[model samples]
Target: MIYIACGAILLALGLIWLIKPAKKANPLYGYSSYLAQVNQGSFAFAQKKASLYFALFGLLQLLLGVGIHLLKWDRYFLIWLLTFYFFILFPIVATEKSLKQFLIKRHELPADYVDPDKVKHEKTKGFRDRK
Candidate 1:
């Protein structure tokens, strides 16, 4: 029963692989929003914040999931956390490598989202703009 539950959890998380990055055509901004102050060219700042939250949440979920499986902790909670991580953090981490490869192969990639050049300054500037 435990293994079956674990498998179900994994499957749920796997399904999230479909909706990884939460970005849409454009995210609506609001004063109460975490992105309330976000402006144009703030990709890195925004990306960093989003990535940090995603990673933090992802790690927590992964830890909880692994804990459930390995440490025999809260099974249901872990499973749900794992599912959430799979969709959320997995996509953010994927903004770099394996995710890119998978997306490229599966034709689920975003348009005009090219890899940045080695120019860290330019990249930083672009991501730091307050537009």
Candidate 2:
């Protein structure tokens, strides 16, 4: 029962993140990690990737919970508890690793390389319009 509830909550959150991710790097919402918060590109990529991973993991958790319940695995509560924790934490780790790979790829660009997205964003707002 607990696993089902937790899985549902995770799935809901993941869906929300996917539907409307935070546009800016704010501490209050979205996948705000040091690497993710480094730039708008990383932040956006992290949010999208994290949402997918989370949703996938959440669905897996829900199925696992159902299986455990059907098989009467209540006797091995500790094992199930650890599995729950793994499902919760594994997505974050996977997202971070993928984010690192993304950053590394971006860094491979030439020194004079300019991100068109950043340029467009800057052009839309004045210097004092910083958020």
Candidate 3:
């Protein structure tokens, strides 16, 4: 019963994530890490990529929970509980690692490559413009 409830909640959250992924890399809503916050490109990419992984893993969690219940696996409750948490954690870790690798590769690329989404700073001609 607990597993079923947990699965349902995960499924619902996954669907919500798939439908409306976080648009920005704010600390509150989306995945937050130094690599992810490197630029808008990384931020958006991390959110979308992470959300996709999250949704798929969440579905797997739902199935695993249901399978445990149907198979009468209550004797190994602790194992199943730990597995459930691992399912939740794996995606987050994988996404962060993936993003880190991507950022490293991006940095290795040519200097001519520019992130279009990066905010442009205007030059101030006078002190008043700086205000």
Report lDDT per candidate: 0.43, 0.80, 0.71
Clashing pairs in 2: none
lDDT of 1 by residue, 16-81 (tens): 433352342234321112221233323333343444444445445555556566765554665565
Which order, best to worst by TM-score?
Answer: 2, 3, 1
The per-residue C-alpha lDDT of model 3 at residue 86 equals: 73
My TM-score estimates for the predictions, one after another, are 0.31, 0.77, 0.70
Which TM-score value belongs to model 2? 0.77
Candidate 3 local lDDT, 60-84, one digit each (tens): 7778777877899878887776666
Model 3 lDDT-worst window of ten:
108-117
Error in Å for residue 41 of model 2: 0.4
Candidate 1 Cα lDDT to native: 0.43
In candidate 1, what residue range of length 10 has the lowest lDDT sum? 29-38
Considering only N, C-alpha and C atoms within 3 Å, which residue pairs clash in candidate 3?
none
* Candidate 2 per-residue lDDT over residues 27-117, each given as its tens digit: 8878888778767888899999989888888888888788879999877888777668888898898898888779888883234545434
Q: Which candidate leads in TM-score?
A: 2
